[model samples]
Target: MLTQLALGVGILAVLVVSGATGPAEVSPLDAGRVILGHLLPGAPWTSDGSLTRLQDQAVWQFRLPRTLLAGLAGAGLALAGALMQAAVRNPLAEPYVLGVSAGAGLGAVAVITLGSAAVAGLPLSGAAFLGALAATAAVALLSRHHGMLAPTRMILTGVALGSLLSALTSYLTLTTEAQNVFSVLFFLLGSVSAASMDQLAIPAVALLAVTLFALARARALNALLAGDETATALGVPVHRLRGQLVVAASLLTGAVVAVSGGIGFVGLVVPHTARILVGADHRRMLPVTVLAGAFFLMAADLLARTVAAPTEIPLGIVTAVVGAPCFLWLIRRGRAARAGMLR
Candidate 1:
């Protein structure tokens, strides 16, 4: 409870900071006033109008969307990661584990390299969504055994498929014009700076739907922690639940990846952090994970923008730098704990 409250407050604070922050750099108080002014419309929140037209545009148009998108992307990916971890009963499971990122990358690269005409003039995001769904379907088909979803098989299959998709994406990248390589690579690395209000709709809807569904089925996810046989014994419908979770996770991943590209580590690491802070109970941990992921990504995006100023770093690079060390630490900690238990 305390943890949730703390996480919630942290998320709000980071969002406020993120909204105010950028190359221009608005103070937190001024940012809040800008937000209130917009919300209230003709209110006295900014009586002096010291924010200026450019500042107001920066806050409302560019910074706000980017911040909100970062929050949504983080929350969606984290929830999806938590779902995958629970469904597969594996600590390392993530949206990327199911080949979604690789597949989406392939789709995005196709549009970038081959031109939109190749895919019925589909936008990058649409193509990427299709690619994500395709990868998920392949993983599902390969992982199923005698009408049951096997966690071990799914993980192995996802890895193999993800590798293949990644290879194909690389091939496309190599074949494209040399000049366009940078743009393709940048998208591959991920950034929310390109965010627009229009891009927010789909991801926002998907996140809300998935969060609600996951909350409602929190017990089933918890049952998964106890293993397939135990979950089945509890009338948890293990196979069906696993299927639903996979699809939901895939949908959330596709929507976010469509707009934000392949921002990493939030899905892979945030859930574990949540578990550590709030324990393994999905009902308790899920919400915390969502909030933590949102806060982490918003802060990360802020850093990506301000760290290099006008140059801007890839969001994925920032996450990987942070996540890689955390992952190693997790491995070391897990092994130490297991050894302690044996002793």
Candidate 2:
């Protein structure tokens, strides 16, 4: 509970700070007032002279949406990662284990490289969403042996399909005009600079729905960690639960990637970090993972915009730079702990 409170407060602080950041000179207090003014009708802050129209516009219109989107994307990806890791019984599994991100990248790249007309007028986000769903369906079909979903087969098929899609995405990227390469690269690297309130709905809904599903099935997930046979003996319906988790995780990964592009590591890093803090029980770890993911991404997004000053770094780069080191450290720590237990 203390950890959750700290993370929640940290998210709030980062959100306000991110809103205040950028070329415009909106102070943090003014940013907070701007947020409060909008949320609270007839509040004193709404009439306060300290907040200017430009500040209000900058905070509410320009900054908050991207910040909120980052949080949503982070939370969604983290939850999906936890679900995937549990379903596959693999510590390294992430939301992209199902090839969803690769498919999204392929779809978005097709629209960007070939133009909307070539793709039958589908926009980048729409194409990406479709591609993600297509990838999920393909993996689902291929991973089944007879009537059963096989975890090993699922992982292998997803990896094979992801590599194929990535190759295609690369081919499209390379054959395109040199100028369009930058846009394609930027989309692949990921960013939320184009965010708007309207863009928030899909990921937000997916995250909420999946989080609820995960929480409700937390006990089943816990049982699955023991093994398929053990989970089945415990009355967990192993195959059905795993199938549901895959669908839920794919929904989350698709929703996030469609808007935010390919922000990596939130899924891979955040859930493991939550486990380190709160243990592996989904009931306890899920909420912490969601909050921690939101806080982590919001902070990373803040750094992405501010670290390079007027030139914003891509959000994916920031996450990789931070997450890689953290992940390595976690690996080292886990190994040392295991060695000690053996000793």
* CA lDDT of every candidate: 0.86, 0.88
Misplaced by over 4 Å in model 1 are 326-343
- Lowest-scoring 10 consecutive residues by lDDT in candidate 1? 334-343
Query: For model 1, what is the alpha-carbon lDDT of residue 30?
Result: 79
Residues 94-161 of candidate 2: C-alpha lDDT, one tens digit per residue: 75666888999999999999988766799999888888889989999999998888888888998889
Extract clashing residue pairs from model 1.
Answer: none
Best by TM-score: 2
lDDT of 1 by residue, 143-221 (tens): 9899878899999999999999999989999988998798788778888888888889999999999999999999988
Point out where model 2 deviates above 4 Å.
Answer: 334-343
State the TM-score for model 1. Answer: 0.94
- TM-score, candidate number 2: 0.96
Tally clashes: model 1: 0
Q: What TM-score fits each model?
A: 0.94, 0.96
